[model samples]
Target: MDKTLHYLFDPLCGWCYGAAPAVSGLLESGGVSLELLPTGLFSGEGARPLDDAFAAYAWSNDQRIERLTGQRFSEKYRDRILGDRRQLFDSGPATVALTAVSLTEPARELEALEAIQHARYVDGNDVISLATLADLLRALGLDDAAAKLSHPDAELLGANQARMSRAQALMREFGARGVPTLIVGSGAKRQLLDHAAAYSNPRALISQLEAA
Candidate 1:
């Protein structure tokens, strides 16, 4: 039987970005059917401006993530994303873009997600912008998804909400508190994997997933 893993994450979340490498490792190990669930934690009403207080807090949290996970949270990201006040720190557009990817090419959704995360944390690009996301998707050879994201239709928007609602429902069911929650197994026999291992030790995280 294929081991099912539910990755509950928010695209704009720093910890979720920190957990990417470990999640990728888990996926690459094979024999696992993984689902990428965007929880919409930092979207809609959860979205906020890039104010000074939040920026400092974000950088501090980001540095901790970098120290623990070895994920690069670049200076450009600090300066451009958190430093620049014009951009709103929102994940709705990026989540919608991922939904578009899911609609067009389901298998490549993870790839699209990684690209979006990299754009924000490494490349320091405006991930909230539809144009930017479209360009990034096109760069990944996902022109169809890019086009959908560039001009999102009703179906895409509805699917985006549905996907997030499902993820959030799973979280509530499992009593999961935050982003990057990993729920393994299937049906009535689900197991919530440890979140600490994702940042502290990815190898251990993968082993946990395999065992689950």
Candidate 2:
């Protein structure tokens, strides 16, 4: 059956970035109504500086993700994005930018998310910066989102917080621990599809979801 799929993720999550192809496949199938849930996992208190230790850890994981999903974590990205200690590993700004996209150009939220991920992991752009995010969205013809992101007001900020809270509540309900959680269906018939399949074989989820 075609069901509603709730995808729980964070803007700064590498695995979620790796799942892009799978996400695209799911969309192409035209079999489900996919709802994105931003968890804000790397925002506020979860945010941190890009220190050497964390950089190494992230790089190691990035390599694995690259091998598994073929999503590049370029040397430029490693040097300019992860290698810079001054950069904050916060998803807050990017989340707000996406919130702007969700509000304005609702159809292209995935496009925006993929662009943000590519900027960080492949193109070596600083996605956590408001100015950078604003520019990126504008480039995608999302001028309204870009304008809103340029100066995030209280309403935008509140919406971002509310989105994260709702995602977190869903995670709690499913007893899920992290990002890339896919919960299919709704109400009493909800089911958690194996997230591993998204990384292993992007198209596998279509069959899995069909079976669900």
Candidate 3:
């Protein structure tokens, strides 16, 4: 059997951020092949605006996710992003930038994810703009995102869309309800891990996947 795990997540998702440590741990264990599937839960063409009430709701929920997973959602984010007068929280450009990096420099996808996450959840940078994304890419030693944006060979945008399609297929196949989902197995046999407990315990998912 190929000891591989498919990690499906959205870059802007709070739950997915919370799941980072476990996922990172699993990745570091070297026992499984990691295939990241970005879901674009808050990215791409159809992202909704972040209204005041909606922002508050998201922050409260994010607090819970932080508590459970020990992931930090800094006060800087609240004060600088949520409380500030500026109102911009679109994730499309960030996702597209990530897609670009993933294609042109696949080895640094995890670093890109972390940089974006820190920018939003810690530094409170407006990650929706191409300029910000480009700055992050440059900071992380990736190519100049502006150049990549125009590069005809970059297949990340399309690949990101394809990943979303695969995520939908996985959701339907596993009867999942939302993002930050995991399907442990392949073909006709698979185990779904959508709840916090199962997600926190990789061994539980491994057992279920083996049984499946």
Candidate 4:
């Protein structure tokens, strides 16, 4: 039977940054297919401005992530992104950008996610703008792919929505409360891996899935 791994996450999530290394490791192993699901966990309809309180909270959380996962939350983002305090903290554009990239070049979906994340979290670029996203995609040699990201008729849009629905269904199926979740099994006997292990070491979680 073909095995698949469903990775539910929101682009603006801080913990997702911490989980990047493990996710990259899982992909590099070539043992499972990762389905990237985008959840708008932060910022709603319109882009919400980033405030001092929000920045402080994010910095605290990011510091914790850095301490635990060894992921660098650069000083540039700390001083620049948060310092500017002018840009909105919206993930919709970035999420849609990934969806666009996925439609044109499915194989590079993860790379796009990583790029966008690095753009926002490290390089301090605003992922909420079409121009910046296009620039990033072009830099990745995915300019044409990025174009499809904004198309109204792209099938990947439906795929992205379906992925979100599947994630929510899994949540209801497993009594999950948030994104960055994991579900193991094929059909009726599936299990939810909601423990801290799922957060820190996705490889261990995948090992558990293999055992299951």
> What's the best-to-worst order under TM-score?
1, 2, 4, 3
Q: Name every residue pair that clashes in candidate 1.
A: none
| lDDT score for residue 92 of model 1 | 92
Worst 10 residues of 1 by lDDT: 203-212
Residue 202's lDDT within candidate 3 is 52
lDDT score for candidate 4 against the true structure: 0.74
| Cα lDDT of model 2 by residue, 71-134, tens digit | 8899999999988988999998988999999899788898899999988888999998899999
Q: Which pairs of residues clash in candidate 4, taking residues 3 or more apart in a chain or in different chains?
A: 100-149
Clashes of each: 0, 0, 0, 1
Candidate 1: residue 209 lDDT (0-100): 76
lDDT of 2 at 11: 88
- Looking at candidate 2, the ten consecutive residues that score lowest on lDDT are 26-35
RMSD of 1: 1.1
Question: For residues 1-212, what per-residue lDDT tens digits would candidate 3 score against the true structure?
Answer: 45556677777888877877776665565555666777666664657667788789889998998777778999888887777555656666766777787677776777788889889898888877677778788877787554685453436567768877887788777777776786666555567754465345756555544454
The local distance difference test score of each candidate is 0.91, 0.89, 0.71, 0.74
Please give, for residues 34-101, the per-residue lDDT of candidate 4 as tens digits.
77777656635635778999889889989998887887789888888887766888877777788787
lDDT leader? 1
